[model samples]
Each structure stands twice: as C-alpha cells, then as structure tokens.
Target: MKRIVAGGFFLLSGVLLYLGVHLAAAMYLPHITGWSTPPGKYGTALRETGGYAANLFSILLMIGGSLILLIELYFPHAAATYKKALAERNREYEKKHNLRE
Candidate 1:
C-alpha cells in the first residue's frame, strides 16, 4: 500500500512538473518549440494574451510539483519522526493533566 501510494504521488508530481514546463515553453518560446495558439484575433501570436496569468500559474505548478516530489522522496522518514514526537508530546500533556490517552 505504501509503495503504491508513493508511486501514485510520483506519477502525479511528474505530470504536474511536465505540464508546467510545457506551458512555460509554449508561452515564452513558441518559435523554438513550434508551439503556438490558434489563428484568431484574440491571440495574434504566441503568448500574446494572459501572459502574466499564464506565467504565474506555470511558476506555481513547477514549484508545487517539485516541492511535493522532494518531500515524498527525501522526507518519508521525517514524517515518521514527527509523528512519534507528536505522540510523545501528547502523552506528556495528558500525564500532566492526569488524563488517560
């Protein structure tokens, strides 16, 4: 189960990161990649409209995806340690208050 969940997260984060890069490239370097918007008055060329919004979203996606991937890959033990510490603290608090877990 744990391995399955980790694999799923890895796939999800990879897709998100890929999408961010693809969007950024399409927006800024359409010529190099040969990506462009449809022929219409709204978008005269590549990345002409909603440039700021698209840029912001792409940045967010990249950051979020990378953070998630890093945490899952490098900090799995950190989460276990944190949970143990939290439980210990809770037990101490309960003991001080003369309460049972």
Candidate 2:
C-alpha cells in the first residue's frame, strides 16, 4: 500500500514538473531561441533550429525521467531500506521501554 501510494505521488510530481518545464520553454524560446513573429525577415533566423534552452530542457527532461524511472524500478529495495531505517530509529527510542512486534 505504501509503495503504491509513493509511486502515484512520484508519477504526479513527474508529470507536473514536465509540464512546468515545457511551459517555461514556450515562454523563454522567443528570447533564447530568438524566433520572429514574421519569418523570412532580417535576422529572422537566430538559431535556425532550436535554442540552447530547448536543448537543455529536453536533455534535462530525458535525464530526469530516466532517473525517476530508475529509482522507481528499485522501489522494493528502497522500501526495504526505509523500513530498516525506521526499525533502527524505533529501537533507539524503545531502549528505555519494550516495543511490541
């Protein structure tokens, strides 16, 4: 149940993050890419393709998506480690008292 919940949250966060980055690109492109409203004009083509911002964002999204998916693949291992950490902390707390399994 916890794993399921964590995965759902991660998915939601990833989607939202991607959307925000995409929107930023749409706004920042005109400046960073230097695209003109009217094409075929003087200095009409700045990049003639895409800008650094778009490339950077694309790379970032790819890397971030891969990382998130990688982490998700190891969810079971992470959950186990998380449980062990919690157990160790609980042991420290119950040093003065008994804890029920």
What local distance difference test score does each model get? 0.60, 0.58
Question: Which 10 residues in a row give candidate 1 its minimum summed lDDT?
Answer: 39-48
Q: What is the TM-score of each candidate against the true structure?
A: 0.35, 0.35
lDDT of 2 by residue, 1-101 (tens): 55445555655665666565555545654655344565432223323433444545555655665566667678779999999999999888887576555
Q: What are the clashing pairs of model 1?
A: none
- State how far residue 70 of model 2 sits from its true place (Å): 13
Q: lDDT per residue, candidate 1, 1-101, as tens digits?
A: 46546655655655665566456546654444343355333233324544545545656655665566667677888988899999999999999998984
Root-mean-square deviation of every model: 8.5, 10.2
**Model 1 quality (TM-score):** 0.35
